[model samples]
Target chain A: GAGVSQTPSNKVTEKGKYVELRCDPISGHTALYWYRQSLGQGPEFLIYFQGTGAADDSGLPNDRFFAVRPEGSVSTLKIQRTERGDSAVYLCASSSAGGYNEQFFGPGTRLTVL
Target chain B: AQSVTQPDIHITVSEGASLELRCNYSYGATPYLFWYVQSPGQGLQLLLKYFSGDTLVQGIKGFEAEFKRSQSSFNLRKPSVHWSDAAEYFCAAAAYNQGGKLIFGQGTELSVKP
Candidate 1:
């Protein structure tokens, strides 16, 4: 089966610009998650969605980071007023229902804000 | 409040040597533990997970992990590592909530010296 897929394998933008990263989860996957990874560091949780609603968003760094999965299939992470600190790889993952299931990840979107 | 620690920033092992990556987590109660691997220009892939039951868990690609409650650790190990195993390894923790929010540690960069 096809695994999770993220678009815009790489993105370069100026500071204070807006950016949107897209993710297409595996078919029939009901859970989706977003994370960020900086250089020499592990991924940091950003948000999670169950079905069409956000199940948890406590990990989102700030209001500028937002995600939506209206149809519970594809998701988009939007960043407003991007800063240099936001330069990192944005990862998307999908999993079966439940808290203990394993997650499948995408190739990730590398965002570079100058 | 929940966090993870990967003490080893980088480790080098021979092509046919045993490998172990340490992971420690700080959570209020029983936590879901997981190990993931990422290669360059790729997404994070799950190696193993431990929620309960047997402390020892087997995973994909000849990987395994042991969950030790006494030490609040879930360490990944392999009896013999191949050169292709060189990559970044991440240990993460997730609470039992439906949200499945994860806390990841700084990854360990494994290099195969052969």
Candidate 2:
């Protein structure tokens, strides 16, 4: 893809439901990132992937939030037992050609937990 | 833990007026700095970034930012902002060796008045 691509631009799920958000980073990008943005706030880091390994997951709020990039190309963010407080936009980004490169973002998935 | 702060929660500026948005970071090292803009219901677009070299770095959309090491600040500026520049702007910082996981500040909402 020319840029990072995300699927299911908008998602609505009831409490206790599970949801998965997908991201397809640009070809050859070595790094990927996930973030969540609440209303009237800045985006918060959730996770990061370098190659097939998760380099950092410290920013993830809790056990309910999980993400994986199996092949290092496509990644998925899963939320279990969704809560109304989980309602926010999930953003994905990728950087190519190594260190200090700028990240290109996807359109993002607007997840609304009811 | 690393973090960022954007002081002004909301700012209104007339079209063609000079614009400045403040950002401060708390990090052990001189971290990589960035500014991103997000329009209504859209993904974030990178405005500019600072790594090494010059303290002042140029970015897209006619924006520039200066990284002050002692102050731990990276303030974004534009000589004249357009009406189209009305959006939410985010300031972010990440460690160079931290695998690209970014810590972002609370955004500044810019409302450009014609």
Candidate 3:
């Protein structure tokens, strides 16, 4: 089976610009999550979606960051007015609906805000 | 707040040598622990998970982890490591109450020597 897939494996943009990262979760997965990984650090949660609604978004750093999963399978993480600090690897993961289902992760999209 | 800590920033061991990577977590309640491995240019791969039942959990690629409630720790160990095991290892805790988002540690980089 195909694992989670992210488009635009690498993206470079100027500061104050906008960028969108896409994620395609495994087929039939009901939960999707986004995370950010900075250099020399582990991934930090960004947002999560259960079905078509975002169940928890407290991990989003600020209002500039938003994510949506309209069809319940593909998710897009949008960053408005990106800053240099936003440069990092954006990871996407998906899991089935359960108490402790293992998450399958994508290769991630590396965004560089210069 | 829930958090995970991997004390070792980096470790190097010869192929076929024993390996141990320590992980400690802080959470209010019984936590769901996991071990993930990330290779360069790849996504995070689940090595194992501990939700309940047996304290000792075995995983893919000859990896295993032991959960110690008395110490709030979940340490990964392998009796003999292969060169292919050289990569970054992350310890994470699932926030089940908060929509199953993961809280990851800083990660430990493992290097294999011939």
Candidate 4:
């Protein structure tokens, strides 16, 4: 079975540009998550979606970051006015609905803001 | 706040040697722990998880982990490591209250020598 997958394995943008990263979760997964991994650091949670609504967005660093899963499967993470500080690997993960399920991750999209 | 810590920034071991990667976590309640591996250009892969029941848990690719609540640790071990095992290992705790988002450690880079 195909695991979670992200589009545009790498993205480069200038500062103050806007970028969107896409994620395709597994066929039946109802839970999707986004995270950011900076150099020499672990991944930090960004947001989570259950079905079509975001259940948690506390990890989102600032107002410039936003995410959505409209159809309940594919998710898009949007960043506005990209900054050099936003340069990092954006990771997407998905899991089935329920308790304590293992998260399947995608090959993250590495975003570089220059 | 829930957090995870992987004390070793890096470790090197010869192929066929025993391996141990230490992971410690801080959470208010009984935590759901996990081990994940990531190779260059790949997504995170689950190695094992500890939710309940027995303390010792086995995972794919000949990896295993032991949960020690007394020490608030979940250390990963492998009887003999293969050259292919060289990669980054992450220890994480599931923040169930916040929609099962993962709190990851800084990660430990493992280099296997011939």
Candidate 5:
């Protein structure tokens, strides 16, 4: 089976521009999560979705960042007025419904804000 | 707030040498623990997870981890490392109510030398 996947393996954009990153979760997975990894650091949680609604979003840094998982399968992370500080690898993961399941991750989209 | 900590920023070991990566976590109760590996330009791969049962858990690539409740730690270990083991490793934790969201620590980079 195909694992989770993300589009635009690399994206270069100017600061202040808006960018959208997409993720496709594995089939039958009802839990999806987003994380950001900066240089020399670990991945920081951003948001999590259960079904079509966001179950937890406290990890989102600010209002400038938003995510939507319409139809409970594909998710898109939207960053408004992107800053250089937003430059990092955006990773998406998915798992079967439950807190104890191991998450399968996607090849991240590296967003570089210049 | 739940958090995970990976004490080592970077480590280098000769091929065929034993390896250990330390991880400490803070949570009110026993939390779900996991170890993941990330190669440059790739997605994170789950190494192992500790939810319950015996403390020691084995994983892919000969990786293993022991969850210690008294010490609040889940350290990853490998009897012998290969050059292909060179990558960034992350420790993550999650609570039962987190809706499957994971809190990750600053990753430890491993370099295997020939």
Candidate 6:
């Protein structure tokens, strides 16, 4: 079976540029999550989606970060005015429901802001 | 708030030697614990999880973890390691009502020596 997958394994953008990272969750997974990992640090939560609506966005660092899951199967994380601070690996994961289900993670999109 | 701590930032062991990685978590209630491994340029792969029942859980790649409610810890161990096992390991925890959002610890990078 196909696991969660992210597009553009690597992305390099200049400061102040805009970028969008895509994620394709495993089929039938209703809970999706986004996390960012900085160098020498663990992954930090960003946003969570249950179905089409954003169930939790408190983890989002600031207004510059936004995400959407229109159809409930795919997700897109949008970053506005990229900064050097945003240069890190953006990870996507999905689970069957919410509680104790195992989360399947994608390869992640490494965004390097120059 | 829920959190996890991995005390070791890096560890090196000779091939065929025993291995142990420490992981401690803090949560209000009994939490769901998990171990994940990540290779360079790859997504996270689940090693094992502890939700309930047996305290000892086994996972892929000859890895296993013991969950201790008394200590609030779930440390991973292996009898012997191979060079191929070199990678980064992350310990994660999810609270009862957090809707599957995981709190990850700073990873421990394992290096194997021949």
lDDT (tens digit, per residue) of candidate 4 on A1-114: 999999889999999999999999999999999999999898999998999999989999999999999999999999999999999999999999824788999999999999
lDDT of each: 0.92, 0.91, 0.94, 0.93, 0.93, 0.95
Model 5 vs truth, CA RMSD: 1.0
Sliding window of 10 residues with minimal summed lDDT for model 6 chain A: A96-105
Residue B37 miss distance in model 2 (angstroms): 0.7
Docking quality level of the chain pair in candidate 2? medium
Provide the lDDT at A77 for model 3: 98
What is the lDDT, from 0 to 100, of the residue A28 in candidate 1?
Answer: 95
Q: Provide per-model DockQ scores.
A: 0.78, 0.72, 0.78, 0.76, 0.85, 0.85
Residues B26-48 of candidate 2: C-alpha lDDT, one tens digit per residue: 99888899999999877899899
Candidate 2 chain B least-lDDT 10 residues: B94-103
TM-score of each: 0.97, 0.95, 0.98, 0.98, 0.97, 0.97
Best by DockQ: 5
**How displaced is residue B65 in candidate 3, in Å?**
0.6
- Candidate 1 regions exceeding 4 Å error are none
With candidate 2 superimposed using the best TM-score fit, by how many Å does residue B35's alpha carbon deviate from the native? 0.6
Q: Candidate 3: which stretches are off by over 4 Å?
A: none
> Taking the tens digit of each residue's C-alpha lDDT, what string does model 3 give over A30-98?
999999999999999998899999988988999999999999999999999999999999999999973
For residue A78, what is the lDDT in candidate 1? 99
lDDT of 2 by residue, A14-60 (tens): 99999999999999998899999888888888988889888889889
TM-score of chain B of each: 0.98, 0.97, 0.98, 0.97, 0.98, 0.98
lDDT of 5 by residue, B24-75 (tens): 9999999899999999777899999998999999999999999999999999
Clashes of 6: 0
Worst 10 residues of 6 chain B by lDDT: B94-103
Worst 10 residues of 3 chain A by lDDT: A95-104
lDDT of 3 by residue, B1-77 (tens): 78899999999999999999999999999789999999998899999999899999999999999999999999999
Candidates 1 and 5 compared: the better one by lDDT is 5
lDDT of 4 by residue, B1-114 (tens): 788999999999999999999999999997889999999888899999999999999999999999999999999999999999999999999855667789999999999999
lDDT of 1 at A91: 91
